[model samples]
Structures are given as structure tokens and as C-alpha cells.
Target: MRRSVELEIITEALSKMGPHTPATRLWGRAPDATADMAAEGNVWAGDVHDVALHIVTRLYGRPGTPREASPLAQAEDAKRRRDMGDEIAALTGAHDQLTSAPWYPARPGDLVHVHYEQAGDLPPFGETYIVGHVGAGLMSLQLLAHTLPETVPGLDAEATAAMAGCFAAEAADCPVYEAWFEAGPRSLTIVRDGRPVHIGGAP
Candidate 1:
């Protein structure tokens, strides 16, 4: 499965190479050595909770400077960010769209449907939740729907593996997000409005 996903990513990324070279069409951080991708079985997450880690092609990002900070770090940072360009753009657009929607800045007791973009079939996709607390740019949501890993349609073992990948960053509110081997619910917060978020009314 790891080899398959890696091949898919490499193949798809290389195809888009053309004259416009990409930092890497595939997002997420891997070991510096390409061999580690296989040796360490890094493509798939060990836990069932991380969907993005299961799929190597999952698009996601963390907010902050690049990991490297040496003299050449500037260039490296630019390159790394380029790999995540799509994610950043999507996030910026999500902020714009959500802020404009009736549900923007969701309030406590408000019911809203949060959409999971590009999640294929193995993710939470979209689910209903009651808004909890909102502060410091992080809005707490208490899931209203009875959504368990199994309850999510099409979330089989392989698909479950794809969904379990850790896409969290250092900016994450909790430390569990920092470990790659540790699986969590963290994911690419960016989403496209036009990809069409199937929404529900706020109560």
C-alpha cells in the first residue's frame, strides 16, 4: 500500500512537472532521504484516525516558518512553501468564504456543517456539529452527528488508513499533533468553496 501510494504521488507529481517545476506537487513532510519513504513505511499512518496520512496525495499545511533554519533556510523555506502553495491558497480562500457565509465565525449553540475538502471517500467528508466555543481563531465544535470511524461511509481498512495520516503542524493546539507516528484528527484546514461544500442551515 505504501509503495502504491508513493508511486501514485511520484507519478502524478512528475507528470505536472512540465516547464513549471514544482517544489513537489505532493505535500507533507518526509525524511530527507527518498529511501526513507519506503524503508520507514512513511506513506501510511499506523492509526485509524488519521485520514490524510493514509493517502500520500492528501493536501495539507501548517502555519509557520519552514522546518529548516540554516543560512540556506530562506531558499529552502520558499521551496517547501511552494510544495504547500495549493494548501495555503485553499486556506486563504476558505477564510474568505467562511467569513462571508451566515455561519462564518460560528457561535456556540449554532449548528453548522463543516466540509472536509478533497477527502475522497474515506474521510469525515462533511458532518453536522453544534458550534461550541470560538476564540483565538480556533472554533470549538461538538459533533452533533453520530460519526464514528466505522459510521463514515466507505471508510474501510485501506480507506481508513488513508484517512488516518497526520497532517498537523507545530501551530496545532495540542502536542499530540506534533508527532508524525502519533495519529490524531488534525488535517488540512484549507478547503475550496467551489469544490462545493454540501452545507446545512444554522439553527
Candidate 2:
């Protein structure tokens, strides 16, 4: 009943089947072979086929033999491997795309604008920021100016509340907002009201 014993039985059964020419020898023929060689190849093929069928019948048709994992388990394992392969392929594709993309010129003191909905309000507002640093896939920006009014037609109490609420929500879920607040200017992309803004001759 042990797995080793079962394997040994299978091995012994196969060995008793007798050695004849392997299927590989059938293809090892010269261009100008005799009829005898062709007949020998056909005989080898038949022998190999019969041996293969016997092995299959012995493994599956007999009772009281250790069976491999169920078909469902095998299928699930195959699916997991396929899913992992897909994930790896997707990551590789993204990496290749990023590597092949055109470079954008960005640097310190470069002016850029960002826009997002003000908290508690539907209308979005824009803010201008000065780039503090730039690196691969990131740009740090310092707040240079905001739409908040310090003078005439400046942001009222309701507007200020809306802006704060908007930013607060964005800070929680938006990468751009998180970068602005937490990372202090590193971002994957820069946008103004959902539109991409090019800086420093970036196309």
C-alpha cells in the first residue's frame, strides 16, 4: 500500500515488457536506406506503441493500486500556475512599456499645475506648484500658489470647507494627492482637472 511499493511494482512491470528498439531509433535513418531499414522502423514503431499501451493499462485498469491526485486537484494546480504566469507577464509588459516610454524633461523650480475636487464641493480647483525635485516616475512639487483668495473674490468659508474636504478625500485614495501631501511632490503623473499637463518641453 506504500507509495514506494507501488512505484516499484510499476517499474518492474515495465522492465518485464522487454527491450526492443526505442521509438527514437526510427528517425535515425539516412536519406538512401534499404527496404530492410524501412521495415525495421515500422516494426519499432509498433513495438513502442504496444509497450506504451500496456503501461497505461497496467497503471489505470488494475485495482488496489495507488492513484495520483484527482483530476480536479490537478486542474486547480494548473490554473494557479497559469494565473501566476499571467501576473508575471503583465508585470513584465508594464516594465517594458515604462522603460520604452519617452523621457520628459523636469527639474527643480519648474512650474506645474494640479487640479482636484475641493472637499464637499463638486467643482474642482487648480493650484500651481514649483517642482522641488524630479526623478524617475516621481516629481516633488512645492506649493507656490493656490486659488484661495487673500483679497477680492477670495475663497469664502464654504469654498474653503469644500476645498479642504476635497483634498482630504483625495489624500486618502488618490496617488497624486498622497504624493503631494505624504511624499511632498513625488508623483507618477501630473494632471490639471483630469487633463495631463506637460512641463519642461515634455510631450
lDDT of 2 by residue, 112-168 (tens): 555443344335455666555444545554565566433224566676644432322
Candidate with top TM-score is 1
Clashing pairs in 1: 50-163, 50-164, 50-165, 51-162, 51-163, 51-164, 53-165, 54-162
TM-score per candidate, chains pooled: 0.28, 0.26
Give me candidate 2's TM-score against the actual structure.
Answer: 0.26
Best candidate, lDDT = 2
**Residue range 42-77, candidate 1, lDDT tens digits:** 543322113323332232222222221221222245
